[model samples]
Target: MALIRSILFNLLFFPGTAIHCFGVLAVSPMGSGPVQAIVHSWSRMHYWLLRHVMGISFEWEGKLPAGPYLIAVKHESMVEAIDTLRFADTPVVVLKRELADIPVFGRVTRRYGVIPVDRDAGATALRQMMSLAKQAVVDRRPVIIFPEGTRVPRGARPQLRPGFAGLYRMLGLPVVPIAVDSGRVWPRGFVKRSGTIHFRVGEIIPPGLKREEVEARVHAAINALNLPTT
Candidate 1:
């Protein structure tokens, strides 16, 4: 049953997404407003399919703070990445350079002002990211980055990446850390199971602390879901 549902979901969702991509491409010349509206629609379409077709839903622990701040999210699956776009304020994500180069979607990422991180580029990449992030802050758009730098399996906690700290200090914005338990249901496999993905939004961690202090607080905040519940 799950397999059939997954098949049906891909049949509808993928084509629907492709059409929206083209829609974004056609309206890119107008401005960021039109572009973001199209992306918002695409994110909504994905959630609609995720719920109706796959029987998956979301449960948030706390309210997401107002934007123009940093959103440091737990990286478990692609679910949270797509969910970020659902924000009406429409954040500019710091994602890998490869992802930003993905055919048609890559074009959308650039047009929408995504901060593409070239991991191998070292300090140069970090400086470039800070520059782009500054522009996003000036534009009043929230910045989203997977502090771990990439998706990890459930229960696995790694130190926050250095670039995350670099951006934190550079932006000088409070960070809202969110822990997610999506991999249990939204695994890397093609067939997905029906379940509620929990997003545990932690309290705002203020800026201006040293790198170690900031990293420690955020690391704990985003892995709150991994703590043993007695």
Candidate 2:
């Protein structure tokens, strides 16, 4: 099964990327609405193809909050980011600046309203994120961020980044914490794995809370879902 999945993934991955790239090229220079529509379709199709080719399934627990909420998800695998577009209507992703340099993928990501942050520029990145996130929220789009900063291995714990607190406080929006076991199946850098990926969406942490407090709550939520009891 693993070998079959690997073969299928190898065959479909680049082609799917090419399709999305073409979509990006076609939609470039268009307005946000049209661009977003094309991107959204591309994302949905990408997820569908992933599930079909990799035999991966998603099991989401709890509910996703409505508009204007900040979604702080734990990063475990690249699949988590890709799968998010399956659920979020039209989310603005806070991604690393390096992704913007990728050839076709970068162009598609930018056209889809993905906000890139320069990891090397400390304060500057935060300011830019704040400005972009505020604008996205005002435009009625949800902001999705990975609090862990980078992906970790399955069952491994990573420290949350510090900028989330500043962004949470500045945006003054409710933060929804999401935890997932995508790393177990996708297992970063691996070719393919066939299994179900679990996602647990926790309660929304309201705004005006202290930075440490919010961080603690988000951490607890992720830990709770990661626990064996679930």
Candidate 3:
């Protein structure tokens, strides 16, 4: 049954995502408002598919921060990535450089504006990511990033990549860490179990703290919902 639901959801998700991407591209000249509406609608459609076809739903705790704040999120599966759009107000997401290198999806991400981080580039990548992030702050757009750099298993607690601390220091925006336990149901497999993924927003951390302090605090906060690993 889970396999059938997963297959059905993907059947709808992939084609629908492609249409949403192109829809944003077609309305690019109309500016950010229309593009954001289409983007939000895309997320809405995704959740609808999850609920109706897969019997998956989500719940949130803590007040979602208002204004342009640095949002640090746990990356357990693709579920939280899309959910970021639901949490923030039309924010610019910082994602892996490879996602921006894909064929069709690449063009859409570029058009929508993302801070693509190339981990292989070391200092150069951090510099570029900060540059894009600074502009996001200037535009009063909230910035959402997976501080772990890549998705971790449900119970894994890895220290955040340095780029997160860099953004925290450079952007000078208060950091709000969100912990997600989505992998139990949204595991990277052909089957998706029916369950509720919990999202917990931690207390906001002030900016301008030393790198080590900020990183340590965020590391603990974002992993608040992580299950104990064997």
lDDT of each: 0.87, 0.79, 0.87
Q: Relative to the unseen true structure, what is the Cα RMSD of model 1? A: 1.9
How good is model 3 by TM-score?
0.95
Those runs of model 1 whose alpha carbons end farther than 4 Å from true positions after fitting are 227-230
Worst 10-residue lDDT window for candidate 2 reads 221-230
Report RMSD for candidate 2.
2.1
Candidate 1, pairs of clashing residues: none
On residues 80-123, what C-alpha lDDT tens digit does candidate 1 reach at each position?
89888885268999999998999998998888779999988977
Better of 2 and 3 by TM-score: 3
Clashing pairs in 3: none
Instruction: List runs of model 2 lying over 4 Å from the truth.
Output: 227-230
**Model 3: lDDT to the true structure:** 0.87
lDDT of 2 at 85: 81
